[model samples]
Target: MTPLTVEVTSSTGSDHLLPSKDPWYTAPADFEASIPGTVLRIRTVPGQPTVFSNAAAAYHILYRTTGSRYQPTWAVTSLVIPKKPCVHSGYNALLSYQMAYNTPTIDRGPSYRIFEPPLPNNYGIPPGHQQFDIMLDRGWFVTIPDFEGPRAAFGASVQAGHATLDGIRAVLSLAGHPDIPLPSSADKFKYAMWGYSGGSIASEKAAELQVQYAPELARGFVGAALGGLVSNVGSLYTVTNKTPYMGNLVLILLGVMNEYPEVDTYLRSRLKTEGPQNATAFLKGRDMDSFQAFQTYAGQDIFEYFVGGEADLEACQALRKIKMVEWMLGYHGAPEVPLFVYKAIEDELTPIADTDAHMEHYKRFNVSVLYERNTVGGHISEIVNGQDRAIKWLASVFDSSYDKEGGIKTRDVTVDIYKPPIP
Candidate 1:
């Protein structure tokens, strides 16, 4: 069989030469660990452009996870174990950090991003690399999962949640392994989750799905801090459609097309030459920057590009569930774990009103939530503004005997409106 080549601003590395059309990410597997979140393969040897090779014994894991429909799927995660000891109780703390790469490209996840110099250019280093280094500097063990799944289902929360939880599961399951030197009592490690902006989607979804889908895995998690929460996907589509940022429509469409066959058939049936052209652009350039994706389909609306009248499209009706109640958070119910949700009131991408509604919805569940609505920043600005405070909160959560905060917390979800100091 001849190796297929994909075109983009791509380098001639990555062991597999993938096809232009959906490049299949697969490895020869024995499925030795045959559980829901099991490790199929582990790479002890480090890759090029290592991040923390000096202080941490780094490795990557190819783990088995579930898709949106609970189908057997696979994901990759990078695990870093610190050589030094922990700060407080001498037990190494674990943090599952989800970075919001946003694009539906598997090759550009944290497994590729945190490595060397040139790779981060495309794979996207986390906006909170400084914070990550601070955690790493504290001798913390961190697992960065390719939460978008192998096919890169960017906005698929179910897929993201499973991948996030399963990634941590795979790492913890590695305890007592001869080669990987994890703590003898790995369960003692206090687990906390955090993400900002696009990543906040994955982080929050993981929190929401924890008690139900992964009860055992959820037991270890102390708290989740998420900001720039995407409470309503419908508003996102409505706001971006036909506008200059119409590329977001293309991004979401391309992502859903991979996850939902109905979406693919529905969307493709409507488009003429330009429709497939834009979709193809999304597939080939999965590594597209948000702005680049926007520019590709800029100023064009999906309905406007439809071959017939918008009412004639039945696929739009099927896709209706995704934008509104189905995939969106709060509508599903509240997470059992403690939550730190911060959002900028001036956010342009995800409106604060929807976040308010999401917070209120969670409040009904009696979850102990620390809600901070910043008055001073927009989407990008709020990243820096809300991050430090979130880190501070995580420190407090892990410090004392307060690791386990039971029940849908009864107390009022603390809400604060403050002005973030300008950077």
Candidate 2:
């Protein structure tokens, strides 16, 4: 198939097209015949003044990837080359910055809204773009994969990992593209991964699955930094149910259902059909963003929508399948590269114990891990407070300065002001 390229000088113009309407997102007739990570389509949306303003150039690659069930599929990743040369280690550094766009909505993916106007109160830039700006400012080329795949399987780990690893392959394959400037040789770049919350699901899964799924790219990876991880989906229900994050339960359910038809059939048969809070209503979350889901279903009981409530849902064989496959981390494999993981001790959305168990699982396999547990913040606050540390650790990883000699290292960070007052 011939590659398609569109030039845009402004965010609002005739060339602007949403992912849903864009033909470039469509896979060619024989895409499945190609190997995973094979570039199917390339759309060059040169950096505009308003969108990705910090980037010297940007391109979107539609590449072959595997779906949740290991079926052939395709995904798009947005790649940005920084204006400045690679100053770190005198070699190009590629940071796959996964965005925490937890929705199953394809249009809500970063590549779609990347050139659109920012939502209100977001400082005139789209959400998640700030992270791109920061990475670009550091002279590191960045790639953000729509790792959820064509179906937008939010909670499916295999699909996320495959798309991410394959996205890197797709990017590396573009080293000699005449239009976009990249190192002539792929080995000239050091790669790293960073993601938080929903994004962590992809980054962590990719790290664990790399050795087996994409062994060729494994040696190029320096490390991965994950924060506010959702290690166990089954365990998360207890913490988020009926809370402000209760809506996430719906999103996960719908997301998993998208990948596993059996789960969808099982859920459809058991969900309450009548009333405003029925299964049909919640399933609409497939098109809603994370914020919309939170606002629409906040403080609502998820079990109440089921025919047999929590008990019947627990007995579901379909749920069990995903619980073991897509919902849980470390079941597939362990990371070949070192890891820097951070989490809030009192995170409201995800349990810290889950991350602790996850880290131990990696440690059992001799995976280098540096775990930091912050005593003072919740899930949201830590994203800001831990930003500096995560970026610093990533920088160290890229520059070959991070220490990885010892076994798993754990640190407990407690601010003096957040400590309990003496009686």
Candidate 3:
């Protein structure tokens, strides 16, 4: 097959691009690669929606490359916008598209995948599965924003969110072009956000910034679902001590701190001399094997290097004080749109209590709520199957259920005849 390439354009006319071949993972047999205008594109035809009448449209895959500063440099691929008839009118309405991160070879890093595609047929490496596919099945466009930017932007959740939201805008801008079809006369946009794990970080940051960063988007966003949320960095470190979850957490911390000085400073003070080297090694590798290496080399306990011995706890706290306040645990206001949160009761990776504290603030607001606690899945599993419930609930969000009192009326769990676990 001819190697596909997408020329990602900047706000200006300049371009830097990404090749369309799977950087790491194998492309399914049906993957169609096309370069639309300046953007490199891959698409799957719109299929029937299981619930709604609108044909579920898939990606008009798009990508952008940003330098280390995370500035937009070029449009690497054509924005792949999904198409389906609008619910309000028979005419086609433009929904958003998402790009997968950490999937390609050049984009891969030591500790992290650097947002490339999964290794071909490596079933153990998670990310591309149910929720991501289910969103496409339900008619929402999916763009896995390789948020690592052109340089493999990693740990830059806010930056990732911006690209994802902007990608949607780009798709809408293309909907009216002669080549694209409009399903009906009244096809305006309706959007909802969903992601788990690292993707959740991007989605949540986007939600916080929607009103301030992109008010135009704020009006169009119907709701968002965030699963396996990681709120406080310090709290996460504590959770990873004995649990295997520490590996990814370590890589994410190193990835972000290396790019951002404030975080780097925190790591330097907290970690022993070897901590920095360990971090670098971790970032270079993309899978669990590297995680085990970091764990083994650093000794059985990882917390002392992070939080410090009980004797040195005060010093660690002082160093944390010097770090950026917003980066630590910033205040994100109540979401203007409804929120759907799924958390695992036995999640070994992220602390559920931290999520609880954040939700407490949202509950006080007038926003509606649908909460589920799962018993079977871990972080990655919850992200995949959680969608089985989240998407259906999201469909109901479009339906009339909000009470006159501004609270969401109780709807069935939509899962089964049994109760959902509560953390």
Candidate 4:
């Protein structure tokens, strides 16, 4: 196969343009003709000094990928190559670390936030940058793809899956390239994926879809580590409706609307147009970050934004479209690789029962899984508490020491640091 040609763009200063303002993000006219994963553009970028102090270089790649409707589109992935040699014995290691940038805003992706001088309003560094630093410190290359795709379709699982896989493809294709700085042995890299919360949506979908959508790359994968898995999209309405996380409904609706036209029409027709907190005004206003969503819509009921209230929002035909495998987990297929799955029993956003059912579904298909149900902490706290174990599991896989013969295994544990005084 001929190596894909790369167009290198300059990035010399602190002023980094958002995807919307940068021409480098725009897909070329002939991009549709190229195969998925074809690298269309490349640019050298500054990695977060605090996060990538051990890294040799960082670059962003604009690559061809399929969108939510299976239409040809493009996505960007940020790659960080470490200065040290491989920590895993024989092969190079690559970890696709998906960030939980749960928002409808395209500009808030990791590719933009991974640089110095974090985005305004405490967007700070991307959610998993510290974890990326840990991976880099271990001498593993990390690819942070904007798996939500060009539309920033946050809940569109299929699009996220495609973008995640293609981002890996793009990275592997750039191996040994003089300008890109990838190690020559990148082709032999053992790949693993790690994600939590919204990030888990992409990692889980990519693991399931790899056998069908990108079968050629299946054998290269060691396994995937998913935490805080959202097993069913339909459950979100009941779980998050009037809670502090109620804003998730707005984000999911806006995101899915970008991918499904029917959903857009359905939501627009029903959205209240007169009030300060009306759905129409909120959706049409400035690009929204997840922080803004949480602050603005916290404790508000999502049903109130519609015409007939909860009944209308629930009865809409468009709801059925998103309930498919593309949005719902475990409906499409089982993961082909061994999985290290963990979740908090008290997860406020996603129901533990849904994850329980999801595990049962995968086990029935004979997929190798090591599931851990943490007795303490909720969705947010689990990210910090469960990460040490998750990373250890990933290390075992990359080093070819993980036991694939071990079938489904489940464990219940407590991961909280807080303890009550002796009774």
Candidate 5:
């Protein structure tokens, strides 16, 4: 077995090497500002969803965040500050809400959803993410990150982790505006994370990567609430491929390919003409829904389009070399920050068994965690319906007064099986 000649691109240095002309990927004037987890550019977000729209102020933020290569790259996050102080307890406080903006188009980020409120004919902004509006109404400043990074690596952990954590840092660094006077320092804001499904991936990665990637944030982090967790990509690949949901997985793969040229190169060699045709359709910035994509390519087996069929790519050693699987694989280590993991019993994308595996792994360690198992709905249902419970748990974590009797709250993990009313 001679050493495989690994073909890698020089663009691996900084995602900036081959500019895609995306503003988020574009580096700042000061290269030093491009330091991992720092602010690159600051600007006021347009079309502020009216003051009556449950949020006080809206701003778009572009910050320097790390990607999969652990290199300097930039990403964007949307900041929504509440009108009043947090009624719960101390510090102005912050909440990083990861929106499940699952799409191949780079511009279809959470930032666009919040600001682009409904006009006469603009129905593009679905209530899919309005779920976080209650957090803003709670008097907690919320920062929604494009954790998928510049390349929009949806399922890539390191990139999501770096971008997620850096979004928080960027928001904290913002100079105080009169509407919402932010804490001058980090300690002044007690923060927590909340997300479901795709959003949960970013939240969980940020939580796990905090100690290694951003230890400074550990102090400010109170807890993390992740529902509908994505435990494994291998599992994801198994279920979504060539199925209706295959469209969703392909978008994520394109995300990885855009970042890793070698993977793209390998796939290009194996892909038939129809692959590029499908790729063009995906990047069109229109309806990127999986079911919609399913209708379009229903009987047309994508496997047949591959040079040597699906087995060839799966068997390739280079596929495992992508290195992103290391983070996406669950239970890398027990999170130092408090955790709340919940899932719908019959999640469409991530099954409860997967969530159970995660909880069991965390249980191995004596970390205090709040795990909930709801017997209602699928992945999207958990995101929408279980939000109240998730938000309540996060509030308790953020509250300085709410703690175990004079000590850190560490309890044996309790599994609750409640059937939520079907929505």
Candidate 6:
């Protein structure tokens, strides 16, 4: 077998170490390590002092191999809590994850460090909470996978899922680490996952793949929670294409299109004249920096040049070629364990009907699915506000007895109208 290689890329190289200027909690003594024939830590996002009520430490993982012309590149990392219970059947470790999205920051970019702390208002553990310290207090370890595989492996949801699952395996498989306690190799360990919006997309895919891709990990994934998930790309394109939302819509589309070649050709036919070569460049070029402004530059109004005066048939037919939603319906749900799923009632980015349809599908598989609708927050709010509920649910998964706390719920769903079609 080819040996795996690992290294602490962040502490060395051109990586910039952000100061531990957190407002909520102090970070544990930080250090990076790597092992050969495995993975490496490329960058570290330091824990905060006391800003948000609950915060977690995050890490980025990179796959490394020896003698390869292309050096091992940055992969994924997670907010890690040292000294938590190891809970997998074969492995004894816990790693909470942050999902990937097209926005590029937390989405598919390099991993950000997280400082696990307290819930803002949900837990009432006081305003200034330290997640890392508290997890240690509770005898649980926490880590967040960057989920952006090597090279920020963008837009490939399955790849992101596999990477997160592998990251947990790698972390739990570690020989000795100060933050985590050692369980006799004989002890069956456990694990849990939580993510929202783009993060949820990655988490959902991860849960679905854990059983087949990593059967050894089958027994450990006890529970998972995802909110505001992007479960259907075809549906998303149908509603958001050519509208202002289409800009943000295109990034994910392009990413997925890149991952699945048939979709790429479909997009090329609909949007690329002579190979929408520019599409790939544009996708990685713009992060969430100006998502609201992309329509002006490349959306339908400007893209009409390539559509060849036809829109519906070719575009819709081409989209069907990908089968992203049909694929979603086929996904295996949260590993025969307790599951939690929430969707914003007024989500602007993801369609509620799609989310509903997806939940109904999961029911067929007898998967424990909890789909909540938030009455208050919008798309971005789901990302920010959903963290509290996400973490609390994750805590419960890590320790089954910790489920007494109340989680915020949502029900009212509404759809935003699209402006006149651009083409």
| Best model per TM-score | 4
- Candidate 5 has which clashing residue pairs, if any? none
**Count of residue pairs whose backbone atoms collide, per candidate:** 0, 0, 52, 0, 0, 59
Tens-digit lDDT track of model 1 for 83-119:
6747566545788989877676665567765664432
Using all chains and alpha carbons, the TM-scores for the candidates as numbered come to: 0.82, 0.92, 0.65, 0.93, 0.81, 0.65
What is candidate 3's lDDT per residue for 66-169, written digit by digit as tens?
A: 33344443333222233432253322223332323422122342112212334542223343443444444455544344444443334555555555565555
- If the candidates were sorted by their TM-score against the true structure, best first, what order would they fall in? 4, 2, 1, 5, 6, 3
**TM-score attained by model 2:** 0.92
Residue lDDT tens for model 2, 246-312: 8888888888888888888988888899887787887888888777888788899989888888986
- In model 2, how many backbone clashes occur? 0
- Model 5: what TM-score? 0.81
State the lDDT of candidate 4 residue by residue for 1-423, as single tens digits. 334456566677656788888777788787899999888888887423444677888888889999878999999999888878485566888999998888787888889877654444332223555677788889888899999888889889999999999999889888877676666755578899999988899999999889988898876799999999888877888988888777777888888888888888987888888776686555842377667787778888888888788887668776776777566788779888999999999988899999998898887889999999999988877887788989999999998888986468999998885323333
Runs in model 6 lying further than 4 Å from the true structure:
1-10, 13-60, 64-74, 82-93, 100-108, 112-140, 151-154, 175-189, 242-244, 261-305, 309-321, 325-335, 402-423
Q: Distance (Å) between predicted and true CA of 274, model 4? A: 2.2
Instruction: Order the numbered candidates by lDDT, best leading.
Output: 4, 2, 1, 5, 6, 3
Which regions of candidate 2 fall more than 4 Å away from where they truly are? 1-15, 46-49, 120-126, 415-423
Give the Å error, residue 131, model 1.
Answer: 3.1
Q: Give one digit per residue, the lDDT tens place, for model 6 in 309-338.
A: 335324565445434532253454444555
Candidate 4 vs candidate 5: the lDDT winner is 4
**Ten-residue segment with the worst summed lDDT in candidate 3?**
8-17
Candidate 1 local Cα displacement, residue 381, angstroms: 1.2
Cand. 4 TM to true fold? 0.93
Tens digit of per-residue lDDT, candidate 5, span 1-423: 100111111122212211144343465576444456566555455545463356766666677787777777788887776777574544776889887666555656666645554322121222543565677767888888878766667657678877888888877665343333466556678888887777787788788888787888777788888878777655666555565556565656566666667777777676655754444543442334343454554444455646677775675565675534533444445677877777767766666676676666666665567767766666655655566778888888777644522212323222333344433
Collision pairs in model 2: none
